[model samples]
Target: MRIAVIGGGISGLVAAYRLRQRLGADADIVVLEQGGRVGGVLHTRELAGEPVDLGAEAFVGRRPEVIELMSELGLDDQLVRPAGKRPLIWAQGSAHPLPGRTLMGIPSDAESLRGLVDDATFDQVATEPQRPLHWEPGADIDVQTLVGDRFGSQVVERSVDPLLGGVYAGISASIGICAALPTLATALDNGASSLTEAVRTAMPAPSSAPVFGGLRDGYGALIAALTAASGARFVTTMAATRVARAPGGWVVDPIGAVDAVVIATPAPVTARLLHHVAPVAARAAAGIELSSSALVAMALPRETPLPDNSGILIATGEPLRAKAFTLSSRKWPHLAEREVALVRASFGRLGDDKPLFWTDEDLIAAAVADLSTVTGIPIAPIEVVVQRWPGGLPQYAPGHVERIAALESAIADLDGIAVAGAYLHGVGVPACVASGTAAARRVATACIENTQR
Candidate 1:
């Protein structure tokens, strides 16, 4: 059998690898990547003579997909955990401990945000449960509107934005309530008396397991392992123009006919490819917008006096060009042993693309200035690496869940075409891995059916 996997990001690579396992050695699996490299946003490089991730630094360890894959690849020794240091939030020109016992910064109780917000805002949050809440059962809305209206704008900006920004490269305003905080939505739907009560009900039970994990050698190791195991022919620096049904299966333009096709590109690219085969999905996919961001990973002298926190997140409207900083040495034990201290500054957001246009020198300067502002320490980096990810993350706008459902349903009727991408579900690495595996399963099953027929 012949198969085509479009896009070479984590999703596509995972799909290719899974296909090889399911379809056996005789099957020809080809990965078509528009970029020259396969990892896509999961790039890693050497800094200060050691590996550092330029794209995604870590994966949610609670999700077993990533860790399971690592074990399967004999990369168990590369697994590493964080130092369990809590991150700080820079708000109102000062650093404050990130509020605990909160669901992504939406405090379960007002007491958690004591010193972070003003008196009036604090009072409002404290009495929030007394106020009657009106929520539609299946309603979908942006996080800012719901949060700002209920908990006050301070809560939305100071608490919600900082946490959401790290995950989506966007503030609460750009993210949807249901998709980003499904548990909270469920609580509301179950007739919680107020937002405060809903937040309390939705809060996950505390666990002792580490929240995140990373590879000792960076994500490059994962990418290399997946590529080697897939044994697929790679067509890089080329795009799949279109996909349509052929005589026995499907044809991915520029790659010829294949037994099955997994459209693993971004939302926009997926929309384009499915235009003719699945118009309903195409429109829904096209509606999903993307956000851009840039990163400045710097190597400073190990003696630099940075904070002991894992990272610092700047509250929305903060007078700073960077949104967050990951103090790598403080967060990861493995990274701390390096010759130089490592820090990563993130720039831009969903609605802001100005940082992507800035030169490397400009980004580095901003990182230095911002770091100095937040940490109250001198900033001097011996080496710097800049990476820009334009349209890297997709915005989970209001009704995102519905849109994805419609897109998936529309494509399900197709004989040998499947879809997998970050835009379809959660944007994290584990979700992408799950998506790729599911797509490969669907395509492999279809190919087997065709052969039987």
Candidate 2:
């Protein structure tokens, strides 16, 4: 049996590696990547003698896909975790720590509201139990409204919205709550339920669960390891322009024929590739919406004054020059040998949709200005690196899961072809890895069954 996997991003690489392991010399597996390098959105660079995470950073430790996959690949010794610190939300010209014992910014326990909320706002939220009517099914909960109703406007606008903005790059109102945060949504469905109960049930005891860790050098190392271990044929910068059906298999045009194919690129790119193989599927893939985002990393001299902790987030309501900043030096001691600080600024989102067309120079300038405001330093950036992503991240809107369900059904009738990526399942790194592994298994099993027959 022969198989073709399009795109060399993390998802595609994982799928190809698994295929090589399962089929070995009996099957022909090849990977094609349009770009000069792999890793997709995962990009890291060393500038001014410091490591900067230009793309995806930490993976959720709760998810086992990344950890298990790393262990299998013999990367267990490279895992390490930095000291943890509290995250602050900057709003109204001041930085405020988020309230604790809260689920998605909703205070479940009254004590959690301590100094974060005003008396009037607290009294208003206390009236949630007095409402005359109960919520009905399919009643869309505007995230802003839900946060304000349960806690206060301060919490919603200052903390919740800004944090969600960083992830979705879109407003929280239109984003699907269940899709973005299923655990919090499930808890809400169980009744505004107490925060204590939610905490006890929603997350496993901290002592029982393993802590989160990242590659010792960086995430880029993980990608390099996968590429080296995959013992399959790999061709870079060879874009698959067309795909057609041939006798006993499908022919990925501009290339040759293959028993099966896995299209693991982004939605827009994937849609274009599927245009000929399944026109209907192409149309559906094109309908999924995505936003653009840019990351500007600046390395300041050791003389630069910065906070002693993790970093600061310019909340939605803050009058800032940029969205957020992460103090890399404080968070990760190994980032630099000297006392120099690495500050990262995130730009672009709905109502702030300007970064999509920003020039590299402009982005760097904006980032420095925001840094000056947050740290009270007027120093210039010693080194700057700007990374822009066209369709930043996927925003799963209402009934989005259903739309994906229909898309899967449309492709079910097609032979020897399957799709997987962040677009199909969850958008995190671990989820993408899981999707790739699953696709490899499905195709491998089908190939074995056909050979037996």
Candidate 3:
């Protein structure tokens, strides 16, 4: 059986690797990457004589898939936890420490949010339990609406927006509550008396393990390891333009016939590839919205007085142009040991194309200005690196899960075909890994059954 995995991102790599494991020497698995290299957004670069992640920096340690995958690859000892985890919110012309005991900015204790929100807002939040929530079970709703209705607009803007914005590059008013924050979604769906109480009840006990984990070297190592272990033929700079139904299986354009195919590219790319064979899935994939972002990484001199915390998240409506800032040197212990300080500032998001229109120099200037404004530090950086990701984040709008389900149903009858990526499940590394592995298994099983028959 032969399987073709399109788009050599982490998902595609994982799919190809899992396919080789499942089918052993019998399967002809190949990975086609249009780019010059693999790893997709999981990119790492050298700065200040040390490795710094220009793309995804870390993965949630609580997710088992990533940990299990690392263990399988003999990378268990290479995992490095953050030295500091407290992140501050920059708002109202100052930086405020994010409250502890909160779930996605939803504070479990109203008193903990005293400095974050106004007294009136706190009073409203305290009285929220008395008011009955009215939400249909399993129904989708915008995150801003649900949180704002219960906790007031101040909480949504001051607290929730910054956190969600950092993750989705989207406004909470448009992002689906359930799709973005499933834990809070469940509580809301169950008609919880108070969001605070619900969050407190649902909060997991604190663990010594850091919430996030990263490789000692970089995620690039993981990608390279997967590529080496997969033992699949890799075709670089080859884009799959189309896929058509052949007599026995599918024919990927320019790649000849394959017994099975996994479309693991971005939603729009996947849509175009499937347009000729699966129109319903194509339409659904095309409908998914995406947001673009840019990161300005700077290597400052060691004398720069960086913040003690992990990073700072900029609340919406703030005067600063940058959305957030990560003190890479402080957040990651390995980076701190270097002679220079590494910092990353994020720019642009959904509905904000101003940064996208700016030249690289202008973007860097803006990021530096914002960093100085937020941190009250005006030191010049020894080096600057700018990375732009067009359509970097997929926005999970209301009814997104249902739309994905419908898309899946539309293609269920089609043989030897499966789709997977951040668009189908959670956007984190672990979730994408799981999606890729699952897609590989589905296509592998189908191809094996056909061969047996």
Instruction: Please report the candidate that would top lDDT against the real structure.
Output: 1
- Once superposed on the true structure, which residue ranges of model 3 sit more than 4 Å away at CA? none
Candidate with better TM-score, 1 vs 3: 1
Which tens-of-lDDT digit does each residue in 154-255 have in candidate 3?
888778888888777887886896777777778766777677666876677889766888998889879888999899999999999889999999899889
Shift of residue 181 alpha carbon in model 3, Å: 1.8
**lDDT, each prediction:** 0.94, 0.73, 0.86
Model 2, residue 62: distance off in Å is 1.7
- TM-score of every candidate relative to the true structure: 0.99, 0.90, 0.96
- Model 2, position 78: C-alpha lDDT score: 66
Model 3 residue 322 lDDT score: 92
* lDDT per residue as tens, model 2, 287-341: 7788778888888887677777667877666667677787777766566345567
lDDT-based ranking, best first?
A: 1, 3, 2
Name the lDDT value of residue 19 in candidate 3. 93
Off by over 4 Å in 1: none
